[model samples]
Target: MRNLRITLIFSIIILTISCKNKEVKSENKNSNIGQFRFIISDTLAYGKNLARISEYNRKLKENESSVIAVIIENELEDGSTKIDTFSDGLKTPFFGISKYQTGKHKIEIKVEEKMMRTKKLPNDSLSLEIKDIYYTYKFHVFIKDKVYISELNEILSKQMDIEYNENPI
Candidate 1:
């Protein structure tokens, strides 16, 4: 009987440690900003002719889709800023362009709850399920040279930060 009691106590301690490890793994997964690829095809082109190309992959539920929210701030030669905001999905490669030509540009990309897609269910119903899914990502890029593609690509590529977050509901 004494041996049985000791065995049970040891098993309980092991079980507790296992549970704690699982919890820690969950937290790490939530905080992880996975990898992505971003390239500016025409980095050396004029500001208005420049284009952005990127790709990111994520597993989503049947009722869910991936989206990207972007904010672009371009500083003109006269010291004024042009701001643009738009949203797009990640099911395919992302291609985008800006309409300004001179000065510097700051680009910010976010992937969060607000990027959620709203779709009607088969029976025209809506349901919510609480799941342990959290994704948060932020990517920043700066464009300074709008003249030579090779040089600008080298400079802008060095300034790219391709982290993003996603916590879907």
Candidate 2:
């Protein structure tokens, strides 16, 4: 009977060590960001121009839906232009000058979504602009809904530069 008890105790110790090791490995895996991709395309370009930006989220949930905001700007040579913003699942009207020279214009899209629950009121805002080209776009995602704003102001002053350039496209 004594020998059987010793064997049982040894088995229990080994099992406990194995379980702890497995848990440590699982935690390490969770610490790394999972893979994800965001597709951005110029749907109105008639298959001529396109761009895309992608990012990975470490804590992204498997069954969560993400909100995306897109903006397109048309720049003219004579120091004038138009701006447009579109949401992920909405259609936007194609508006632009009929015959305008197309140069190295700027196209920017800002996407923001809540990754985790927050107690404070959510006021997330992201804006993108190309100054020399005279174009800009802004997108804000809140807990309740999302907003898209387009403006043609002169190259954003230095103060607003941080907000526009730091946002993840």
Candidate 3:
């Protein structure tokens, strides 16, 4: 009888701990102090642009909770605007959009702060570096005269602290 009672107590403690952990995890997923967006500049032709957009959009839709619609707006020499897009939906309450191009380019981040609030960090290693990591709500990238809107939802950034200018020289 004593052994059974001890086992029952242990089981109750374990179940309580697990329930608390699950609650914390769900809360963290929705907590956000603010959001940001990325502006990248590159130069790619229309065909190349289309291919990149298709591949990136496919990957984002498959991976993330939010689906991004990539809008390609080209400013013609005659002052007419040409626009092309992939996917369809309203862009709001988005998880994030990624950077479209690789290598050197001018990239700017604009953070829209919600409200300042202090919160404890997660014990996981990834959460330790979350502040340095910027999450983009929607991306508006300019490759030459063509503007790619929310073309991607992932950025392959090697270093978080680094910045690139339009012209280094």
lDDT per prediction? Answer: 0.37, 0.28, 0.27
Which clashing pairs does model 3 show? 97-153, 98-152, 98-153, 98-154
Model 2 Cα lDDT, one tens digit per residue, 10-98:
33333222111111111111112232233322122211222222343435333222233334564444646655443322111112211
Per lDDT, what order, best first? Answer: 1, 2, 3
Estimate the TM-score of every prediction. Answer: 0.40, 0.26, 0.20
Stretches off by above 4 angstroms in model 2 are: 1-59, 62-64, 75-80, 90-99, 114-169
- By TM-score, who's the top model here? 1
Q: After TM-score superposition, what is the CA distance of residue 22 in candidate 3 from its true location, in Å? A: 31
* TM-score, cand. 3: 0.20
Error of 1 at 80 (Å): 0.8
C-alpha lDDT of candidate 1 relative to the true structure: 0.37
Q: After superposition, how far is residue 153 of candidate 3 from its true place, in Å?
A: 20
Residues 1-169 of candidate 1 have per-residue lDDT tens digits of: 4433433343333322211111111112122334344454322344542333354556665554333433345445565766654333332223334434434433443322221333456885543322222232333334435454555444444433232223221
Best by lDDT: 1
Worst 10 residues of 3 by lDDT: 18-27
lDDT, model 3: 0.27
Question: What are the RMSDs of all candidates, in order?
Answer: 17.8, 23.3, 18.7
lDDT of 3 by residue, 30-141 (tens): 2232221222323332223222221221122211222233334444445464553333222221222222333333322222111111223578311111011112222233
